[model samples]
Target: MSELLSVQGLTVTPANNPGKKLVNNVSFTLQSGKTTCIVGESGSGKSLTALSVMGLLATSLNRTSGSIQFQGNEITHLSNDALSRIRGKQIGMIFQEPMTSLNPVLTVGFQIGESLTVHLGLKGDALKAKIAALLEQVGIPPERANAYPDELSGGQRQRVMIAMSIACEPKMLIADEPTTALDVTVQAQILALLDELKTRMNMGMLFITHDFGVVADIADDVLVMFRGEVVEAGSVDEVLFKPQHPYTKALLDCVPDAEGKKQLKPIDYSWLEAA
Candidate 1:
């Protein structure tokens, strides 16, 4: 339960327009072995917040202000080379779409081994063995490691992404809607696998999603974002069962109940103007 990452006063703005903040001042802390879910609709800046922490904001966007501390060390302004050293080894990220994130030409095994080779200096038989082990760990057969990303199913491709992220046994993981593109059953399986891995390795996880159902299944803490600001933050039960913010309540109203007893409603933001 130790503090693994701390982010304070994070702000992201366009390179040309410093005053136009895409992601306004936001703050949160993630502890080891815990999952913190950032729940928001599209364009609410949840992904931007995660990118700022990873130092992966696009060239068009600039992180104007923030203090990103990982394992008590400030990484807000680290150079690309310095951040590269920490990225795969200490902090790993699973992008939303596995197909685009993975290289189609390279074998999945080779791709997985790249991080292990670069970070741990593993090679030859040792590297291959580790790659096989990682594939197995993520529920993919070791033999499939030789196959290309295009050859695998969508679920399998996502599993490959997960395998690659956890291969280095990083202390923290940032997953940006990793299950968004998968089917329902596969989504559940991937979520379960991630939860199991996080607990086993005690890795702190920052999960980004718009689904409250997913949040209920995975989140230890929840942060509800609206237009680049965290409108509500609390434990899973407090936020889900006893939401304090109107935006949170509105968002929850959109989710359909399991027994079809609750009517799904679209979020209405007209109240904001009146407020």
Candidate 2:
């Protein structure tokens, strides 16, 4: 019932071009045990928003304005050392691609144990048991913990990423298009796994995806973003079935119905501007 993360008037701009605002006054609140999905086209600043929340924005991008509060404390201005204390401990992040995010040389189990060692100071038998349990929790066999990232399939790699993210039992999880590279079936399975974990851990999940199908499957609350601005935010039913914003309606029109009865329509930018 309590808000775990609240972002207000958040704005991101490229360091070279101060006029270019990547994220424009974006704001939202994520409650514990709930999943909020940010949906939009590529370059819509959805990923930037997530990075900003974790204070993980790149050096080239500047968080010019806004406030980010996590667990009732303002973190937007926190020092790197302070944010580092919370990054993998209280807040976990699953990036878009597991291959790029994970280390190719290290075994999956070792990577999962890294967070525990750093954050919780687990070692020896205790660390081993925790890593094995995490592997099983993400549906990976405990034996596979010994496998390298390249040795596993795409889905397995992602599960490893999930295992790493939740290794510390973070209160909030930020997933940036985590299922984008997987097949439909794998995507569904990943979504189910994430949803189950969220419920079991009572974590506030900020899931970013461009796919409406994923949104329909896992989101409790939906935030529609266009050009860095949230045009609509509401319960899944309200925004998906009875969308009020023109952008929301246009986005809905683009998704084919379950039965394929409704025709899929691409967004008409001119119409969005007009509306």
Candidate 3:
């Protein structure tokens, strides 16, 4: 099957210096219904790469050179209006912080249904039914639909964000640390929910985070980014277990334990015996 999203020769620069780059020659393909993780420590520009695909870069920065093709259409030069149309309908996003992403003044239902209104032009009973169904799909009760963000727990708020992201059933979803602020169990649940949604919707996923544990639990493929470049990338096993990059090894060394232990043993080095 053809790639659902393809990024080529992607390079991004800070607005302050149009010539100086932050994301250099970054590129990857997202296949339908599979999870691709962008893993790296801080300053790796993983999040920025995802933003470039969504055309959600900061107003100041520019795509110096490269093409972002969504289902064969080059989106690099797409207008703001065109990008807006493609955003919620063709590409959905779940930010790291749900509280900040969602409107404090709006009811959860309103925020969840806003995409339906914008992307599907849904209203009245159709919108109502859709919103209710979306809440349920994301594992939230219909009663809580009318509740404000302040009234919900951190996990529940994240659910609302997921509901909003999957509202239009976009072909591709970008989850930027969807489990950042939640408890361990809640984080597991959210990852499971995203996993289920991806399978059910047949959606491609670009999951960005610094957490290797989360990536291990959910990623099909891993792209290890370092200093704005993809140092290593392949199947999860290749990148996680049999990694060839020193930066990748350094990252895996830092996946901490609940007891606040010194470091974690390498997954392959500890998990299995050599064949």
Q: Candidate 1 — worst ten consecutive residues by lDDT sum?
A: 256-265
Candidate 2 worst ten-residue window by lDDT: 260-269
Best by TM-score: 1
Candidate 1, number of clashes = 0
Give the Cα error of residue 170 in candidate 3, in Å. Answer: 0.3
* Model 3 lDDT tens row, 57-142: 99888889988899988988889899999998989999999989989999999998888998899999999999999999989998
True-structure Cα RMSD, model 1: 1.3
Provide the RMSD of all predictions against the true structure, rounded to 1 decimal: 1.3, 1.4, 4.8
Candidate 2 CA-lDDT value = 0.93
Model 1 per-residue lDDT tens digits across residues 113-191: 9999999999999999999999999999999989999999999999999999999999999999999999989999999
TM-scores, one per candidate = 0.97, 0.97, 0.93
Give candidate 1's error at residue 66 in angstroms. Answer: 1.6
Better model by TM-score: candidate 2 vs candidate 3: 2
Report the lDDT tens digits of candidate 2 across residue range 109-199.
9999999999999999999999999999999999998999999999999999999999999999999999999998998999999999999
Q: Considering only N, C-alpha and C atoms within 3 Å, which residue pairs clash in candidate 1?
A: none
